[model samples]
Target: MATAINVQSSCSEAEWKARQRLAACYRIFAYLGWDEMIFNHITLKVPGEDDAFLINPYGLHFSEVTASTLVKIDIDGNTLDGSTYPVNKAGFTQHSLFHRELPDVHAIIHTHTTATMAVSSVEGGLQPINFYAAAIVPRLAYHKFEGITVHDDEGPRFLASLGKKRMMLLENHGPVVMGRTLEQAFLNHWVLQRACEIQMQTLAMGKPVMIGQEVIDKHMANLSQASIDPVQQGVPEFDAMVRLVDREDTSWRE
Candidate 1:
């Protein structure tokens, strides 16, 4: 059996902080019911380290994850930091490609929520039919599902599909959200999840009214102009959720 390792003592201050934040993200996902029983992944690039990143240890539920338990691995999927738990190969296959290619994308989230998967499997993908959808529709990208994401051959195709977009819906699968920071990635996923949920509900009702392109553009413009500090994107919202999770269980910070 593999024993637990003291990760904080061995890592730098910045990396330790990254580990804590990533662990909290897992707990937040569990709290939001976005976790898929240890199947999905959320990865963050290790601070001050090139070609290295962090991921949840396989076999543990998201709620069981803690700062000390996240496995540090390189872009090529080799586990560093001497973590005993194995890395999820499928998670590595998908997340590594983006981390290697996109220098600006420090955080990546992949989930199999019903609403997101439903939106992905839909014919037209996400439409600008509601406020949440209208805000993100123009930035959303789509990639055809290529079965489970374990194969190395699919890497290039995934990159090509994403291009310069930060969010992508995998046809017949789920969603992948990337961000310059972890908080931004979480916020993006939140918005996308809401949009899909509302779309599913609206479709069940009847033919839904779509938002006008001009209105969506205007809304996006207004949002851009409303930011008090672009660099602090998603920090406030993510911190609020962190506080909620802390109230529930601070074990994730262990």
Candidate 2:
């Protein structure tokens, strides 16, 4: 364990790479027009810590984010890295609820994308409609609104409602996903955002809803098999997305 700590502490290069990629994610989401200012958050669990995470500083938009700019904070919202930029205490509430409760969750992304919010506002919540819709997920949680999640008292509901699920539709809000790795979380967010977009656009046509669980499961399995690591597949195009975001802004590297 001590050797591991030394490696983590001494390995500035590796840490820098992690931060750069994470920062790129923030900027890419911002460019995708998914950000709702500081209202939503995307958090990554620290490499080896159990009760710690990295979240956005309150004022910066995702486009301006960089690896170093991300604030390191404990589950209680305490800043561990001496960052002057205050981490969003209220925003941390929902993220903390997940990171603290789920050990498998290394990355958590919360978004306020249009279609997702629209789907969340509906009476039944996300009804899987197409192949994309079928990927909505299994065991999705629907948590009732208790106003903005800032207070610690709200943790129980957040924890209870999430209850070992990857995705949660914040009733009248949007969705949050817990990923075991940064890339997996990113892939999940991509699918979910697309699902919400498709649901919203198609629902406007007044089409029938997809209620078949078997269909959803089938396509979901396909999507899972299709899922692979960006770097592992030699997908230079994956970094292209990061570059696209970097071209827009590089403040995230600070």
Candidate 3:
């Protein structure tokens, strides 16, 4: 980690701040036990850059990520920063594809958490039994799994599956959440993950009590009108998680 720290780069103050937020996001992922070792990724679009995006270095643990260690890459999946670490193939295919096509998306979080993967493998995908599920069900999209995404051909299919939706479940794979900011992405992941967890738990207790369509539709409508700012809706929990990471180790700020 030290070797990668403070490496020479021409990233602007805004981009550098984006790096810090992305790094903190990785740390908070670890804090919440949502990290899956070196697998999975959380990415942010670089401020003021058209094609450049910031992602975690391929081999590092979520806890090991830092502002200075993030790697910048372009739409072509080429590393723009002269870092020793390589970017994950799947990360580029899934993240860069969306960032390139969706002009409004600024951040993305992909995870293979236990509950989320379980839901992905199940029929009907995420359920609408709980408030969390109902709130997110309206924006949910499903993409059939096409093995490991290494080829360029999967790009268009991935984007099409996620068409205009902020949350997607990759069939037999995992869930991906897109947001206008890292804060929003994290919040989206939290809601999606919890919804899956609740569905799994409720199923374990014999048949689950399904919420009615009228009630579920009402909640969905309310969520649509709620504040979109992650800071406004998620700051209370996000700040607490940041504090937890800081207490453990502030290396993520490097």
On TM-score, who's better, 2 or 3?
A: 3
For candidate 2, write residues 51-158 as lDDT tens digits: 878887778777767676777789988977666787666678888878888888878888888888898899988777765557665757889988887778888878
Candidate 3 lowest-lDDT run of ten: 1-10
Question: Using TM-score as the measure, what is the rank order of every candidate, best first?
Answer: 1, 3, 2
Would you give me the overall lDDT of model 3? 0.86
TM-score attained by model 2? 0.86
Which 10 residues in a row give candidate 1 its minimum summed lDDT?
1-10
Candidate 2 lDDT trough over 10 residues, lowest sum: 1-10
Name model 2 segments beyond 4 Å from true. Answer: 1-11, 209-211, 224-240, 247-251
- For all candidates in order, the CA lDDT equals 0.93, 0.75, 0.86
**Per-residue alpha-carbon lDDT of model 3 for 1-254, expressed as tens digits?**
32584743576788888888889999999988999999899999988997999999988999999998899999888878777788889888878888988988988999989999999999998878887888878789999999987778988888888888989999899999988878778888999999999999988888777778898887777776876654465656677788888998998887
The lDDT-based order of candidates, best leading, equals 1, 3, 2
Model 3 reaches what TM-score against the true structure?
Answer: 0.94
lDDT of 1: 0.93
- Enumerate clash totals for all models, in the order shown: 0, 3, 0
Error of 3 at 56 (Å): 0.6
